[model samples]
Target: MTKSHDVSVQDFNDEDSNVSSNPTFESVLNARLSRRNILRGSIGSMATAVLGTSVLSACGGGNDEPAPGPVPQFTPIEKLSFAAVAKSLEDKVTVPVGYTASVIYALGDPLRAATADYKNDGTDADFENRAGDHHDGMEWFGLGADGKASLTSVDRGLLAMNHEATTDEKLSSFFLHADGGKSTLPRPAAEVDKEVNIHGISVVEVKKAADGKWSYTKDSAFNFRLTPWSDVELSGPLRGHALAKTKYSPTAVKTRGTINNCGTGKSPWGSFLTGEENWVGYFARGAADDAARGDKSVVALKRYSSVQGGASRHGWETAGTEDKYQRFNNSKTGASADGSDDYRNELNTFGYIVEIDAYDKTKAAKKRSALGRFAHESAVFGKAEAGKPLAVYMGDDSRGEYIYKFVSEAVWDAADASPASRIAAGDKYLDKGKLYVAKFNADGKGQWIELAMSNTAIAAYAAYKFADQADICVNTRLAADAVGATKMDRPEWCSVNPKNGEVYYALTNNSARRVDATGSQVTVDSANPRAYSDVHKAKSSPQLGNSHGHILRLKEDAAGAAATGFSWDVYLFGAEADASTSNINLSNLTGDQDFSSPDGLAFSPSTGICWIQTDDGAYTDVTNCMMLAGLPGAVGDGAKKTLSYTKADGSKLDVDTYVGKAPAADTLKRFLVGSIACEITGLAETPDGKALFVNIQHPGETTAMANIANPSKYTSQWPSNAGYGAGKRPRSATIVITKNDGGRIGS
Candidate 1:
């Protein structure tokens, strides 16, 4: 059954109407032209007036609501041309006036005693302890006053970054064959071990200069890298599960390093939390393995989709028979029912948020199993209030998944940052919190249904048998499904408003959504808000799935993440505003806010500005994926607006609730655009807001090996473009942005 609601006028009221008092576009342009006294500027001055009039009229009305004031404009401090360097052969990293960046670390960078010096040319023989490939999300933690683990020390800090996954030939030096395809066979035992070690998190200490420049301190005592091979312990709910047991560790209390570490979070007590994403694809399980074990439940089979003898994408099983290498295979070969030696349960070990105390490397990191397992993208925490339950919001980055939140069992204490604190903080707070999955009802309101094992629906699920609360926690997806939680478009990254406690999630995309299929396909729901197939923009890269994603906002009751009920609405939809007015383009976006496949998300605590970064392959025609900054109004600001879309078949598809108007440049603006073939991910801000750190991942990504030698043949050459010739291989780097006059960013 389809449900629809009427738009409300109260939803369009701008919360910042009182403080947003910038000049109109025409006035600003006239002021600049008058100061410059340029003939060309005067000739185009009239065009600006016409556009400004339209924008002013749209934002102004006779209704009781206050009009949105003139849009704020920023004058560039400086536009530093691309630096000319040999490292950046293919791509470019554009910096505004007074800002600069460098490659602090990369794929083959050495991390331990095994590899001392790194050969940036990709000829390193040992990578087991080296930095992993495809660096994604990261965090920066300041050292303490005693030169220990302080959260307030600005001069010295630790940077923990995740290596999401490796691109085929880039998996290792030997994995790439001469034919340009991966060697179907697995590597030797040593090679297998190396791959495991490279697939986790890289933790290093960085020191900042008096002038605000940051660099890695290789000799820092606290600097260390955690990989899949590192021995780690399982904490929280599933610590002693039979599935977690292995010959290497019979207790099941301890496991190994995390894999597919993606979006990250930081603890109030000064620690790092890295999330495991798409971890299920790493194991290979034969379909017959489950049946032979006499465990053929539909739920088990569906959860662990093992159709063939094994599904090892990296061919790690071909390495050796040692449990270390063979554990990647989930096929059952033993006759015993215990299955203690088998890898079938290895898949369960991943998909949890692994917590690492960067200050004390000797401490063992714990996987907070309380947070349900599904392609976890990130964990964002709400502001920590002393003596209040600590709230954390997370996302499962899969099509048609649900968002999750966890409230600590114990109230937060500001004094807990001391060294004497035990795992007690994690044990008392994170381990026993109530895990709630979201359900957006039809009335624009949502409920946080508890997925605890005590819940009857979760306890009686027919799929995988839930023996107890621990089982339900380990199999959180099953628990969430049993309670009929509302499914959403791939919930990727989440950011909470420190100012008002509002939660925002990136609904990346969903291809399974259809307009007709009533049961399986996603229908038009209030939170989802749209159902239409996306059209491909590039002929070579056909956009098959829901590529252009959108953003969702949830306003908790009483302005707190601990609130059980919340109001939700579609904040933005990715579309080429100039495209067809039908299904493909629902949001009437202009060039300013129009973007596709929103991924990484972060909010500036100082400015209360939400920065939305994109990881898109859908709309590459107009420009590469870009980042947009917006001053979001509260959740109900546009709750009553409706949008009408004309479909490809010439029929109309109507949508309700606040998504039709163009944001004034002051409300939302394009802060920056990235270079070609790069995803603008990972953001960190200094405490004083004096410097901003941003990561440029996988530049020159589309370049071929044959073009490696020629700078002109590559797609980008960024930092080195300053004065050198083009065509240097692009090196992924962390950029430091600061105002020339040392003012706060976006201030």
Candidate 2:
């Protein structure tokens, strides 16, 4: 659920709890001053859990296309062509000299031929047939001219994007209502309907015109939505699970919808895997609900940070007593111990990786529960070998949560890459996998600990006794905790470097990080090594903790993704260009490459370029959330470095860790700076790399609900400001970026 301590969804983003303890160690960083011209100097923590040592060396994966898409050959670019874009605070997107960004799809953009256009005032309805709000993680599935999935089409494809959530600060999501909505309890049914429909995922067909411009079809045959009310199945280990039973489906065979979908995954056999995040904030549980459920149930419920009393996110449950509304109230009201008679177990139905075949509308969406659920960000498959078990890398986007890898029981089969039935292929590889939580050590090594009932730690966990495989899957966080998995920063988006099999993930900044332990916050660890005050907050005092997050990369043991051990290093430490060289600016970032809160990361298969996007607040006064293009080296190219930090007690503490090799001007640089109050996320590229699709989420998000009547007081009116829609109210949209000469982007 949203933050319980009266914080806005903007800062919290559904990272349920806070963590506060600083680690003890030594580190020295090499910080740089310029973004476009620095070959910064070397830098780099913790004695983690005892684990076997494993060696990792970089191996460029053979150009592979797992999904049924055009397999464009990748030639790693040794240098970038465009000059770095300058930082800006403008209300419009800024890009380099030769690139053009065009808006193709946006909030309320009609997907059905009969749907009405979005008026952009607060009165729009029929969101089910319109583009949903807050576009986040997205994937591209090629469409051949024959109107089927293709491996050759670049100009035509289906863009499946996650809507994530609606923007709200006060108790209600004001942007969707006619009068900024009711702030108190007991929301209206009409308002709740619109809010609920906009928090899922949308798949629309987009194509390029002869003029080289991209736009979405109003009624593409492949267009559809997996809304909160859509029928879905809980598949894999959680199929027919007792905890999944609800009034809607006593047998636990089905559920209503997917909500708060964040990161997305592209299935090798052609499907869209969307992660359900922050769904906890949508349901409200009565204060007495916890007592009724008793101690054991409360432990799992509270661990998920679901509020026990009063308000639910936007007061969605207070609309009416209909099953549609009542399901939002996760209170124990029925007598069935299996939870078959009430919606008390409704919360357990979410927090999963739901897979849908965008190309095949005949199949229903299925939540693949075998992938241990948490605040899942994005799931990226490692380089797939024809005979090896596929490994899917994932990160729980909440603070101090664990990173995970799911190794399928089935070996890769090239014939299944374009399977006769994508859904059945999902059943083969995704439904049967061993989930492992990552534990990174101070010795620059990491191990994957299995989270199964058979594991001694999980079997004898003193906290909560897991009953079965389904129990372990449902209460994955507890299983991870019992196994002492390394707690991390806010791990968000992750991608496997197509140039090298190494995996890199963004540890989005955590407000809960602290030099001293308290609550959910913890001290600096080797994997999450930075803890300092952010000096960029102009109106308030500097914020403490890892205000500017870092990017961490790990290499799977030599046997590839199926291996249990790995080596790791800090790829890049996000910071302001002006931050200290020895500590905060560990990566020596220059103005051109400097960024904060790396929330979205992806690697281009056509160019082997790393795309980094930010969801930041600490450095917003200086710049809006932006995207950068990077050419990353292997995991351990840089030398070891020691870092020193000052604790609250006025004493210095030292921590040592490995740092990735420094980047030259051409290796990493800012590519685009977004509109006012926006998060630059959801990246996808054509196989040829000629078109880069980016999702600009919630631009002008700071507009006060009170300012609904005063358009001038609105923080942003983008897409509209940039000339796309009707009103001045900003709308989240997908923008396509292309080079002027129609060449591969980042070439």
Candidate 3:
């Protein structure tokens, strides 16, 4: 889990520094309230009454607010009666006794009729029409016979799934035996092509049978794959910027494809927004790039961890001299005016939120650069008011990164809700917006600081001179630093409660944030409170950092999504049952609810039940990564508590914060446990909530590339035991979960 797709590699083993301070608490709060009428009611009580709605959706008196009516309270799940499944180390998918889990789709499954079945012998080659590896984030789009959107069409629909990364050893043959087990040499063309084509999004059609079973519709007209070879256009403010110009697109309006797509979100206009996270590691930089760009460019490159002479994990540069392969090389290899003869500018084309119209295969995907570039995880939408601007919340998924928000310039119009093309509506709103980074304070309040070129602080910063709006958007991390945004601990997936509109984010483990004798390390802040030790099996030394991460909740100002000020609190502190101290387990979690490295988070749109999935290496020795279903209460449902933990050296650490109520077995229960060395991620449910879809990524990941040929040596054989049969290598897949009695899931 410490390793990832890109060069920066800020996984569990990596760390970053350079967090700035926030503005005075009183000033930001006062300025936020000044823009709107002060609430006549108690803020805390009002926040409690409408707990499930996000910060922006619960407030009143705004022009976009609905006509006077009682604000509905979220109807919580009455009772969870299914028994919690026990944690297991067996290489099989385990669920409650009354539930059934089956593999719906697996790697290399053909999406088209002409394609042959996957041989599972590593010799199949129709990757362009087959499923991909490492399925991450996904969404279900309802489709009718007329090819129109329908919210309740559960029997027929399209699923847009993101293939985050590829499996080097399992997916290809002979890559391990070539060059005497060394992959440094030039890889075979076929092997490289297979890997490249398997690292994007897959749009497939699925249908439910009369028995309520789900299966992929192979060869359906709506099924297709968007691989690294797909052509995608650039839209928004930076589309024609000089920095984006290259040999591939001299006019700077187009790019090749999307890579490292991790977490994803569906747009309000019905398009899919797949985030390009960890794309930096996919490009190789020339050794002399730093000298050619000068000192300023080097500083910016270092901030993003774009090493001047670094090589990618897949060695894609050694594949060939063809433009398709050479685009992976970011070196200035050609001698032409404006670098038009080379692919030096190719890396800049990535690290963005790409929009795809799944219903229309004729249109090219658009990379909306106005959303601001960083290591984006998920781009979740806040509540959209009728006449107000739409707001999108996103997190930069790297250690010690900041959270960001994008406010569209155009106001929401009811007429565009069911447009002929969702991509057309995206051009109207997503292409023009203002991007802001968050600045959290010690007093449980935060502000969204604008990262525009016109901001006085940003323009005056000496580190990197601000040229224009495009410049600021490209170097978002640097602008965030200059504006004094709060540095978080690897902010991952974000979800807005549909019932109340409250927002929640998962801050994965941070192996940094300890205080040194000289005070050079990142100190404890109100947000990043815990700094302790957790045992790591790889090293003899204890891991000194926030191994068990936490979850955060936010409530925006009365003006809703576009509001500048918001209130925040720590919702849950992730810890094991046997942590060094009781205080570290601030939520007072019991056996059924405890977990670490909370990675994938999603709230049921129809039921308001929050689903938490773990991608952990911290406590895997005790239990494999798992998924839990929870009925989340309001932000202030519990009283303030202090978390204290003692270090190995006997020194004690304590943190004071507002924690959620301790959960019982009935409120929070383990739903599923994955196979060995796998991450449980990418959850979705149909509108009726009768079926739940979850992805199992990289099973048997601990298998070394040298021993990939032997199935018996594999660390995991999941889906094999769950159905796929024997003598098969462990493959990542999406499994469908349903109650045996045909009842609604999680009830």
Best candidate, TM-score-wise?
2
Q: Residue-wise lDDT of candidate 2 within 652-692, one digit each (tens)?
A: 76667788887889899988889888999898888788999
Ranking by TM-score: 2, 3, 1
What are the per-model C-alpha RMSD values against the true structure? 13.6, 8.5, 10.0
Query: Per-residue alpha-carbon lDDT of model 3 for 312-345, expressed as tens digits?
Result: 7567777787888888888777777566778777
lDDT of each: 0.61, 0.81, 0.74
Candidate 3 lDDT at 522 equals: 51
Predicted structure 1: lDDT: 0.61
Models 1 onward score TM values of 0.81, 0.92, 0.89
**Candidate 1, residues 111-164: lDDT per residue as tens digits?**
554456554443345665565666778887766434555444445566788876
lDDT of candidate 1 at residue 355, scale 0 to 100? 86
Model 1 spans > 4 angstroms off: 1-90, 112-114, 144-146, 169-182, 188-193, 210-212, 296-298, 304-307, 417-419, 518-520, 533-537, 540-546, 580-588, 643-655, 658-662, 704-731
Deviation of model 1 at 190, angstroms:
5.2
Mark the regions of model 2 whose C-alpha exceeds 4 Å error after superposition: 1-70, 646-652
